[model samples]
Target: MSPVRRRALVVTLPFALAWAVVLAVFTGLRDRLPDPLATHFGPGGEADGFTGPGAFLSVASAVLIGSGLLIALGVLRTRTALRAQRPVVAIGYGTAGLLGYAFASVLFANADAVRASRVSEPVWQLGVAFGVACATGALGWLIAGRDTAPEDDPEGSAAPARLPLADGEVATWTRTVGSPVLLFGGVVAVLVGAVLAAVGPGVQAWLIVIGLISAAPARCRVTVDRRGLTVAPWFAPWPRKRIPLARIERATSGAANALSLGGWGYRITGRGSALVFRSGDALFLRLATGREFAVTVDDAATAAALLNALIERERGTSEQRG
Candidate 1:
């Protein structure tokens, strides 16, 4: 009934059940294999290059189960430190070390076999290797990338505390638009051609006019106020979305990765919604209307805390009114 016990049960019980199920299935399948298949891999068959179905299953199970066990063990070993609220730096280092070892083991064991295998074309092989490397590298980075501890800032103090403002008021946010030369030139050419066409006409002039119109610059803007948020991309018309603080459900902070949430721009994931930009820190907002708003901002943790506080205030007001 303690927090640690509750956390341990939540984390370990399902994992243990999953492992048991996996082991049961594996054992059942192995037991059902015909004698011939089981015996196909004779003594030292792994090194002898006798890779039959049984051998494949054995190797697959070892890799899968071994990796899972390693991860579980790591988590268990670090659980105490994590509960003690240790800095993330140590956890990241430990994670990176474990993943690095796992990746190295896989590469050393089968690199040659993978290179010689004809099941996949060279391009496919390269793609698989590249994908694995990228995954491993990303995991390593996430675990060991940056230390989040604030040296000067005291613990429990608001990180870069928000500047004082009028009660119940929000500050405006602004983003500057880039001047696109190509777009401006095209628009000017088209307008000139249109004017000329009204006086005198030619096919070349019409073509020029069309080209100019098509080359117009895209419009983009970033707007923020006391109520909520708004952002418009250049190529498409901006949606009239203004999320009031009263309607926000929750706000959470997470990493910005394309694989995790598709390619950044205005993605709707199963968890909620997000309007992600290509770069910078991201804040995910779950709204009461079942929409999610993903925003890129300078200080994400502060923003999330502020938003959460605002939502709590709104709820308090509603309850009081009722």
Candidate 2:
């Protein structure tokens, strides 16, 4: 089978199997387990909080199934089959092992306990779960294997473009782009956080933090000049990403989806680093170090042409000096 298909399975199968095992084990432990299992423990490892079997299992399934599907989607949807794999695989297996062991331990802890209050969790089991996670993580990394460098990715070509420039003449290109998706997501996250604070988990504060960070820069400025490309949030003077002319090998414009570079925002995949506020037309740069940089923006063609022209001008001046 194709490697991409294999990678999807490699990352996704572990979570499914883990969830299945949990279900099977729980079924066998029905009579032995307390009706309301002691799901939470105190610092001393004594049972402090209780939950029904259905509720505990639901939470476990959500954690395992939801995360697995998300990672699988990321792996399957990336533009290149040569995308980074080791980290992705490691995270998948590590999460599966950690949660799997924790869930299993909880079930075993409640086993034969006549009542929830009588059950006690072994604090040492947390350490053991981490150890198992680390070992399984290594296994996943081995399974994912090596991947080709970004320079070898077959997604698209980087044919250089040139803007005719007279001697002593210079040009610059600039544009501001915004992502509605980011703006919407930020607002929703904050609202959800607020609602959750009133009705659900106390982790709502994190959601608010994420929302603020995401909403702060839905719009960013993309500039291409003799200095090379610079990207900065609209509200900040300090640019988030910058690529100097000396480091760039060439510039090109291409149709690229932000997701292809791996989930939005600034992402570094096996293909390259990208500042993707949104997806669509983008300016691409192949660096002197054999790495790539990309940013989604309108008028990307103009930005790419200007960058390429400036590169040629620099090369000509260097050759004359030599």
Candidate 3:
């Protein structure tokens, strides 16, 4: 087997085994349990039958296990593609499974009675199964999704030569200017404050106004050019601070744990050393000066590959000259 296939099988095997075990236990329990609703409707309830908790658990386990396996298969098959695209596809499959269950429930099950009871036993069972499957699938994708080598440029152009920074050239990391989420939140807050101010005049109304002003978006930027690295906040009257690139020890991409990192406006994390633009991935720059800078950009892997290529070219040129 190819390395990719081997890796996929290894990761998926344990989960599959666990799922089967759980399914067997659930089935056994369902066959042995007595009907709970039997007392409610007397003898009629006995005739109506009872679906045990084990049945629900079995369904959930199946969904979770099945989804996980499918996600693993997807990763194994699409190992060379871009990282961001894989999750979307895997998640889509999980979502479809949930929708399928919902459709079945609506067509054949008593959805109104389920809702009236407020128990949602079936939905919960199916959701848990679906969620487990999706989570495992996502995990599989993350573990096996990386490409060992940089993808070739589609343009088929020769690689560019890297020019050394001539004494004063600098490298910096900075945040992107403007955040749509912060702006939207600020606008909403301001509108709410205005409404409160118009309704009544009091200390609380002024407090709302203050809160609105304080919540306004703040901008920060990092720039590196011929001069040096500079970091400055947007919409602020301040001088930019210069930082040298030689101080940069390493740069790596940040993983998005929550959708928050890649959703609605700018999100800064990793101790504020990284910034991700509206729905963009983060890049971390570890400087020799013991400071880190983070910037969010689109297609981080491609950028990283290009930067690595440039660095290799520069090193080669230096060696040839010496």
Scanning candidate 2 in windows of ten residues, the lowest lDDT window is 148-157
Model 1 stretches astray by more than 4 angstroms: 1-166, 173-224, 233-237, 289-291
User: Per-residue lDDT tens digits of candidate 2, residues 112-209?
Assistant: 99899989987899899999899888878777665443422322544676899999997888999998867877898899788666653333578988
* Per-model CA lDDT versus the true structure: 0.44, 0.79, 0.44
Number of the candidate with higher lDDT, 1 or 2: 2
The true-versus-predicted C-alpha distance at residue 185 of model 1, in Å, is: 19
- Give per-candidate clash totals: 3, 0, 8
What is the alpha-carbon RMSD of candidate 2 to the true structure? 4.4
Runs of candidate 2 exceeding 4 Å displacement: 1-6, 40-50, 114-120, 146-156, 166-170, 175-219, 255-264, 268-272, 276-282, 296-299, 317-322
Q: TM-scores of the models, in the given order? A: 0.33, 0.74, 0.33
Cα lDDT, model 3, residue 212: 54
Best by lDDT: 2
